[model samples]
Target chain A: MDSLGLYVLAAAVLFGVGVYGLIVSEHLMRKLFAINIMGNAIFILLVAASGPVEGAPDPVPQALVLTGIVIAVSATAFALALMVRLYQETGQATLSSRDEGDDG
Target chain B: MTAEALALIVFLPLLAACAAVAFPGRWLGWIVRIGLLPLPVLMLAPTLAVLDQNVIHLALAGHASPLGIEWRLDPLSLLMLWLNVGITVLISLHAGVSFRPDSDRGQRFWPLWLILFASMNALVLSADLFNLYVTLELVTLAAIGLIAVESKPAALRAGMRYLLLALMASLLYLLGVGLIYGQTGTLDLYLIAEQIEPGWLPVTAMALMIVGLLIKSAVFPLHAWLPAAHGNAPGPVSAILSAMVVKVSIYMIWRLWFWGAAGWDLATAANLMGLLGAAAIVYGSLAALVQDRLKMIVAYSTVAQLGYLMLLFPLASTLAFQAASYHLLSHGLAKAAMFLAAANILSSVGTDRLQRLAGVDQRRPLDVFALALGGVSILGLPPSGGFVAKWLFLEAAWHQQAWGWLVLVAAGGLLAAAYLFRVLGVICLHPRKRLNRRQHREIPNLASVAALILAVSAIAAGFFSAPVLSLISAGLPPGVTP
Candidate 1:
């Protein structure tokens, strides 16, 4: 396969994996990890696809992807904290409100 | 002066947030509150000056050719910036007084909030694609942190779920950016539009990007993370998340569709969006109707309000686009007011359940007024900006002969009204609860004032629609008549 084709396939695989993780993972933290990995995969695809403009990966998308990475991690960290809080207060990880005496 | 002012608009909060870390305990909350004061003034002054001017582009970092970042200001941006700063100030004010000095995780809240403000400013000001992505990430991170702060188990789990979804969305968006770069070899949106061919690559990139952003915007099927995350967050945090954070992703969606990939046939996409929007309107309203909790009802109401955004794609005209922007601004005001009113009721009852809020209006006249005003705005009743926005949106849809989209728009407003008044009905009914003396802490003056400002803005913005609409039309593309 051509380099572009190879990159596309890889991106597809990563996206698939991310989706799988989202579906399969029950723990909030694990789900976050899967999500971050998925994000990294996309960032790789973006940088790879924009290959070697002026003998360099295009700086603009790179900067954007970098920013995206930081955001991904920050959000992950925050969510982890929230998950821990949820576990401590309510002793559950699922999102349904039924257990808290909430109807619907 | 402009550069300094713009820089101050973004960085002052960042600096103060960082400085607040070492601040003494007794003053920590106050310090955080003080840190957010300058931004609204900074943004407000420029907005007035740029009232007639359409596009204000500021070049920064001065390195030529794709290296430097550009800050573009437009009426849409100014409105967003003002709301971000204004709402943050009010949220901070409420947080300062309502939170116990010793409670809430010390100085952390202010820093994250300031960072969120900075990122929001950057998101609105951003001129190019990369900057938009970066700013979006910043917003997501800060928002997640805010959600997790409750330190309750559910908050942690919900926050984590939100984070995961956000990460997935960001990754997907990045992948799309990569494809666009490969095809065009440029990151500047304007430059990309010039070089991009009408071909498979750009189309693929657009699809991927839309999917990613749809998740972030919490549009329909991808919106699983929002209701829980927004509902579970602290009151002020919920206000900010609902009022402005989600709108940033929607703004980026607009930037991409309108400016970057302007010529792509959006008919199918528009119809799909319209369908999902319709579903969200009905589903969100039905969901809100059944929600026993106040915040969840409001959170679902957000889903319905968000459906209004999709109307732009179907009715893609200057008028339609202007109406969408109007709805965005109006919804920001009304939703913020709604959340603040909900916060007031929660404080009064030590809970946010609707049934518990019985007799609340009778007991707290201020909260009653706030809820009533907020309800009127959300329902798109007369003299409110929500009404003006719906009127304009309906007008544009009627002009296009897009009858299906028109019906959905009207139906969404009615759904919004149904949900908004459902809670109002509870308050007005005066159910069987005696007010516990201990639960009554005087609602902070700032929260009420903040809600009032937004409520007034929602009503007053109708009068200024002509100017704002004109501002949005500046430099827009004209019809390509043969």
Candidate 2:
């Protein structure tokens, strides 16, 4: 009924969508998109929830969340490169721990 | 030095990262190398000086919090900041010599790495939750970008997996923040901690937030993406990812537990985390022992090392906190050295399989020694930082009369020793001809030196714990028994 309630609902939906995307997505890029969406939702919630301490959305949490988003992207890009190399080497996109023969 | 100097320490690298994109192909490597020049002397020294004093607050543009960016200097932040900058410089320099800039992959790596450093500093100095989040996001983006720098499909898949997990964590964290907002309407961690009551809503908030952080820290079950991401990446990238980036989330959890969510009913959650950490210790070490590839072993070892940080929660003493912080620094150096040593081996042998590295020590003694130093440090052997860290944790647990926690701490050290010695054994005993059959190429001196410096520091931490401990105790809350 209020702004907080609306934000909470939005966060729940965002979380659900992120989970669903993480489960169903096969391509790494699409998964990245889903993850970004999830991060955005979290950022929104953190800022919204801070609730304007002293007539301003608590700047501290907002700054932290912003830093988190950037870190997420950096890590994502690095992982994608690693994935591409893996595919280039082994000719597979999906992760499978199942190997035919044990090295040990 | 003004806050402007501290700001420059973080942003200069970021500016270089952007400038790296603008440079010509041949000059990018030199430009990146030059970019790191000011960091060691300019950024780290003053930070250490600041840490020796009290908390130094810098408001960007002379504006205070809630309206402008702020950089807060504390011992914990200083420790992390120095390590991040120092290691990034070393990694960048190592890459300059070993990495072939002509390769499209190498060109992109430098810029992203600088950005990652900037984000890491921002995260360290961040005073409040929202600021921490923003810097964390910057870190995630650049880290993800670096992972995909290899442009390999597997790396891409790993990146995506990591992204998905990170996203989920953020969302959960957000939900928790939302709940807290509904209850207290403040986001500044200290303020919220002061005003909030120990009710169901706050409890839910705490749980959600901790879980989100746990996912990022990759404690046990949530660590699904770490091995593939770190093990399969390019060598320098793996070093960065394993050595420091992952620790950022753990640091966040530290802030939350001790400062942010101080009075939550943590008995259940602490034990839960401790159990998961214990599982990680045994499972990750066992997993590492059986791994064929060199980097995979180190990657799994990271999972186990991460478990060490969680041990503090169960012990839950000021000494435990200090031990955790100490261990964090020790492990950062040791693991970075291990990864760098592994990279050197990979570059030389053109493969990182354990069996193939039997005679590697004969050819590259410096590298082998570097690896051995890292091994000893990580195993918590005497005179190494890891040993002191383990001792502190055990003492803290003993003081609490928590016998189980002591055993957990000891068991982790033993497991660490087992896996580390396994690698050492393989290095010493195997036939020289097998490794020597491939032509031996001399590793760049800078890489070896970088690894050695870290190894030495890990050992030095044991002797020099006094200053660091005192600095960490500068602004303690009342009743915290350090």
Tens-place lDDT per residue, model 2, B1-482, is 64666878887888888888888488886667666788777775556567556677777778765556666777777778877887777776667766656667677788888888888988988876666766776787688778767665556656656766776776677667666766775656667778787888888887888888888888998998898878767777888888889999888887778777777667787888888888888899889889888888998999998998888777777788778888888888888888888888877777778877887887777778888888888889999988888899889988989898789888877887888888888888865455665466767888877777777877888889887777666645334665
Error of 1 at B380 (Å): 0.9
Model 2 bad stretches (over 4 Å)? A1-14, A25-104, B26-30, B44-53, B100-104, B431-436, B439-442, B475-479
What's the fnat for candidate 2, on a 0 to 1 scale? Answer: 0.43
Best by TM-score: 1
Candidate 2 Cα deviation (angstroms), residue B304: 0.6
DockQ of 2: 0.33
Q: Write the per-residue lDDT of candidate 1 for residues B174-291, one digit (tens) a residue.
A: 7777778778767776567778866887888888888889899898878888888888777778888988999889888877876787776778887887788788778888888898
Question: In each prediction, how many residue pairs overlap at the backbone (N, C-alpha, C within less than 3 A)?
Answer: 14, 86
Relative to the true structure, candidate 2 reaches a TM of: 0.88
